[model samples]
Target: MTAHAPPPHAAPNAASERTERWWHRATGYQVYPRSFADSNGDGMGDIPGITSKLGHLSDLGIGFIWLSPVYASPMIDNGYDIADYRNIAPEFGTLDDMDHLIAEARERGIGIVMDLVVNHSSSLHHWFQAARASRDCAQHDYYIWRDPAPDGGPPDDARAAFGGPAWTYCEEVGQYYFHFFSPAQPDLNWQNPALRAEIYDMMRWWLDRGIAGFRMDVISLIGKDVDARIYEEGPDLHPFLQEMHREVLAGRDVLTIGESWSVSIETGLLYCGRDRDELDMVFEFSHIREGWHPELGKFAPKPFDLVAFKRALFSWQDLTRDDGWHALFLSNHDLPRQVSFYADDRAHRRPAAKTLATVLHLLKGTPFVYQGEEIGMTNARFERIDQYRDLETLNHFEEQIAQGVSPEAFLAGANRNSRDHSRTPMQWNAAPHGGFTTGTPWIQANPNFGEVNVEQDMVHSESVFAHYRRLIALRKESDLVTFGHTVQLMQDDPDIIAFERRLGDERLFVIANFTAQDRERELPQGLAGQADCLVWSHTPRGEIPRSLRLVPYESLAWKL
Candidate 1:
């Protein structure tokens, strides 16, 4: 295959020239702190637990670890509702523990990325408490607050991202406060320069403390409408982001990723464009949310149309080829496990897991591996609704039930798509609690842990963990895989996804079967029998066969 030229506007970061900025070729892993491990027999995972697992990360060949929030929180929404931005939650450990983690991770050549939840703060936060005390207080404007409507109802009819009304009346203050999530998570007022400064200062403090960078939570929501009459996309968001880049991220050689919900390709460029000077990259959810129905919510599962999925994926890839960057991931703390959600978990779990990994990791962007994803972990399979511990799941259940959805039906939906499916404790071994904790676990471990634990996979040559390790190593060795432009192929086939990455003389092709049935297809004339197999999920990794045949959930990568 002939090499494709770089995009007309392509301008990769000059900072990428720095040897220390290995993120260009590195794979990042996300660890949900509470579910990663438990070292003190305290039921909850802590910094110490993560420290002990550095060896595992090193073995996996991950370049960085993105930790979910461990800040002091009321535990209202796991840890997203932060009560204090600077200190570690007592349950997790102290500031010293965090410092130790940073030092230890750096020793293993892995950077620690903190989760920044600056969009909102817990209602119990000092700023929120003070704001609620009186309108004359200095912190009054720290959070978004407005007088009740003429009828003493909410400030406006805006809806919360989670559910219900976005405005909550605080009887003590005789006013309503805006929140995109739960009432306990009062939205911060970015309009207040003081609040923005405080947020930047907190971020700098962490970066100065030997930490790598930040994975901003709901960052797009920070710049919302002045009155917040609607849920999103405010007028002043771009200017605020640009100012933040100038004040906080300009000279630092660190990564900055934002969780950009419902963002379009054009808008995404404003955040991560080569010259935008905002975030280093942004996470877009359009492709992943393809299976979701707006009225039914994510809980009510829906099948994704392969053509639609490819359209969204290719659009982002084509648009960002030159201007911006993307964050590639299949699942995270808020989504269901990829194996069960995107692939066949019942009949072809192993191959499906590896196939999914092949499709995502080879994409032209930074790849993220969620906890347990490398070990072929499936859903928690919680039979009773009470077994789930996630606040989103519980709140969603109540909301659905109130909306006339039958309890059994709602629980089934939760079973298929609950955020809790990805929140179960990491399966480290076959021992009780999956060797995650000695005491009662904060949440139940997946029963399949006995067969899917890391211990078993570490010794198996063709295990899911081994496949991921090889993929990471390959990424490090191939510049084409890391920085090449993508050209999708075979778009008409519903059960197959194929794409090529080309850069000069180097060309790489990735193909996957998204179903359980075996299928065969004629190779693209230019690629037919000319490419050598670089990696394969269920086939020999040597050379591409003359006849192309793919088994259930099989995937392969080839280099020409």
Candidate 2:
């Protein structure tokens, strides 16, 4: 099943148009290039590593692949602070290697989606260097630069997204520059039309290189606040996005997914509605933010709230059902493993993983699977703070410790929520370093990799990998699972998540018990004895009658 590529500028026909919308029901898998696979025995994953493992994704039954940033970078933010947009990082591979990987992935029925990080560039970037050389340079406006405050202090009191002040003073220019993240990353000046034209040209260059599309990073922040605030939202975002679409993506049969923060139903309509022409899909950061407190950061602990989670999920579903598209996901490169975060990784990892996958996949959106998620990977065990490599985690630990926080408590928080947990090498087998590499991996592998790995799980019928494969199969096989309208059932049951999908008499029910204890729920009207089970997290338990019993973390979907 090789991928079918549409002509570069083909005339619109019914079949071609339908094919253009193929991403609506597609299952996308995200591969963090540095952790996916290491083909060169250099302890770091690269484009060749991903190309060598294309068969694994094909075997897992994914339609598209999303590769995290491999662009030329100083690795200050692990490639997010890109130094060059058009070139591949030396650690990842060369331009030829990237082109080869794209071609190989297409041959295996996998469309490649590169990570686009245009919000900021590495301080080492030529443009940033030129901007910092002198304020009178032509490229001075390429990045956001401002004069110091009245009393010869820092610029406006905006805080960085990671922590601390957003402005960094430069002695050479005698001014301050704003960076939403690290000082090594300076935000681009999207208000400059010349910079916008340069970005559009770069996108066209990639599209012409036979790559499919992009997963834009912090794209919402591209629209700056008129008052120079550091917030994620702005008023002029739509116009910029619209112009981008018209200039670069008007006729290309490609997908553009944005990491949009502070999203609402109104924002969804403006960003992803069929008529908006801004983006194909946007990832709203509501449910993923459930475990963190408003004042406390990700390092701080907050008990998971089931009601809040459900409310956010349903709100997005209802909002997008009519006019917009969503990019559904649980775990990504930035967060801990979903099963470990949401379920008991020690007791019921398999069933919990399956339940999460079923609920997200059966919903009305495109599903995204982060690398190693298929095999129930747990969070990394970094007992000491020194074991962590993420800049955000390390800097946060230092900041909190300086502010009178205990090292013991801070390490505990970092162990629980650090991004390094998700950056561990992929568990290919039970060999040394989980068969991820013959040499030492850049980061440590999870100790549980011996039990939870691709080789062992791929052959096990009840493994999380097999369960995800079945769910993806159902999504491709059933129309109701793909395009049906969603309705919540048994909304008052806090332990049970039940939903109905209906598409012109093709009715389907998805019910799951999210806890480790068995739950029994009264069946809805017309559902009892009418269900023919299609997919289940556990073995079939006969027919779903008037009173249905769901095992621990069990999820089942049936056709009526």
Candidate 3:
């Protein structure tokens, strides 16, 4: 295995370099602030709680902690609906509490990354409020606004991301504004040069505050159609991103990762390509859509496409091989837990979680450990459809109902694919609210707490927690997992996922059984070398099962 040499030059600014360079040789852990830790005892997670946990989090060998969102909002879209880019919500604590978290995290060597909600802003934001007040307001141009059709209404072709028409009628302004998500999240008008400069100023302010970088939200939606029609990116979007490139990011050291969900490899490169100098990388979610029916198209889970997955993964690796970087993740605040979607959840959650972790932690790119993934959290079971709090879930459910789908059938699908699966509070203990808060929670905790809480796993050394610690430790110890080239091995093996990472002469192979079946894979000759199963999330007892037999939900990584 041969390790690629570090880039010829480090990032320009000390702070920018701190965000991107720090990660090149370090580990990152993501926190969905609302469910990470609760300090105010208000049945919600807050800044103080996160600050208090810094020592333990930093001790995990993580170098960066990317917070989802702590911005002020009405909680309509959770914190993604940012009311103010500079202020921390009072519920989560004040700006000082945030400062404390940053200072303390820095003291513990955990750099902070903001969940930059650049694509949209909450309807309550001062800018939006002014826009809603009247078209005469200075902020009227801050968000996308359009005149009603000749028929005196919005265009029927535009569809909201959650469902229904994308244009929301504003009686005050007597016009329709575009929203890719909930109506409360109005898309920002990036075509407005003044607006773009304002957004850039916000970015610079955060960087000047000793923060590391950002996780840009809905990046694909940043630059949109400038003509009468909107909600889709146009040729202007690319050149628009270039404008951002020249003004904001160019040679900065801070890491800029975009959540450009459906972007193709070419589009992704254009957004993060070497010459464009837009972002450090962009997320590709095509493979994440595996296991269901896209024909029905409402966050459906399609079947796993190993070949497609390989091609996509390698495309990202190859495209950015010597140019940019890629941000990897299995789950975040917007999707279902990986263990629930990838592994067997019928009876055994442990093996499935560990096996999933083994595959994710050893992948080629930077591994993003969601708040509870390290402890093996599963999806929450919603008892009633109305009980679902996520706006995305509710909107989709309403859409399915309007489509003439039966309520029961629509909810049945929702149970399997709703974004609510990941919003349930983190399961910390058997106590009420999973020890997340001492009061009534802002949201319900998962009912599986008795079987799946941190306290229980901490006591069992062979628990998923132990496996994750070792997995993270291994990643820290090896440069291959960080920057070496990744190559899949025995990729077509039914129910098995195997990949290799080689740096210099050191080569490591990782294999996992994605199903509950015994499977054996014969390495295609070239990989036959002196190999030892250095780490197995679920390797069997004493004999070391050298023939490559995979148990139900077992995963093994070999050093060759």
Q: What is the C-alpha RMSD of each candidate to the true structure, in Å?
A: 4.3, 2.8, 4.3
Top-down TM-score ranking: 2, 1, 3
Q: Model 2, 1-560: lDDT tens per residue?
A: 12544233321222223333667657999999999899988999989999988888888889899999999999999999999999999999999999998888888767889888988999999999999989999788988888888998876788787778899998899989989999999999898999999999999999888878889998999888725574576766788999999999998888899898777766787888777889988988788787786777788867777777888888888887766778899899999899988887888988888899989988988999999999989998688887889999988887899999999988877777889999999999999889888999999999988999999998887988888888888776666787777898877777889999877768888899989899888888888875688878888655668888888999998888
Residue-level lDDT for 90 in candidate 3: 84
Q: What are the clashing pairs of model 1?
A: none
**Candidate 3 Cα deviation (angstroms), residue 241:** 3.5
lDDT of 2: 0.85
- TM-score for every candidate vs. truth? 0.95, 0.96, 0.91
TM-score of 3: 0.91
* Per-residue lDDT of model 1, residues 1-560, tens digit only: 00111112222433233232457777899999999988899899999999999999999998889999999999999999999999999989999999999988887888898999988999999999999999889798999888998998987788776778889998878999998899999999999999999998998889888777899888888878846354455777789889999999887778889997857876888888877888888888888778787678788777867787888888888886765777999899989899998888877988899999998889888899999999988987778889988777888888888989998888877887889988999999999989999999998888888888999878876699989988998877777887788999998789899999987778898889998899898878687665688878987656666568899999999998
- Residue 542, candidate 2: C-alpha displacement in angstroms: 3.8
Residue-wise lDDT of candidate 3 within 457-549, one digit each (tens)? 878766887787777788666666666667776655557777887767777777788777777766555555556766776653332344666
**Candidate closer to the true structure by TM-score (higher is better), 1 or 3:** 1
* Candidate 1 regions with alpha-carbon error over 4 angstroms: 1-20, 226-228
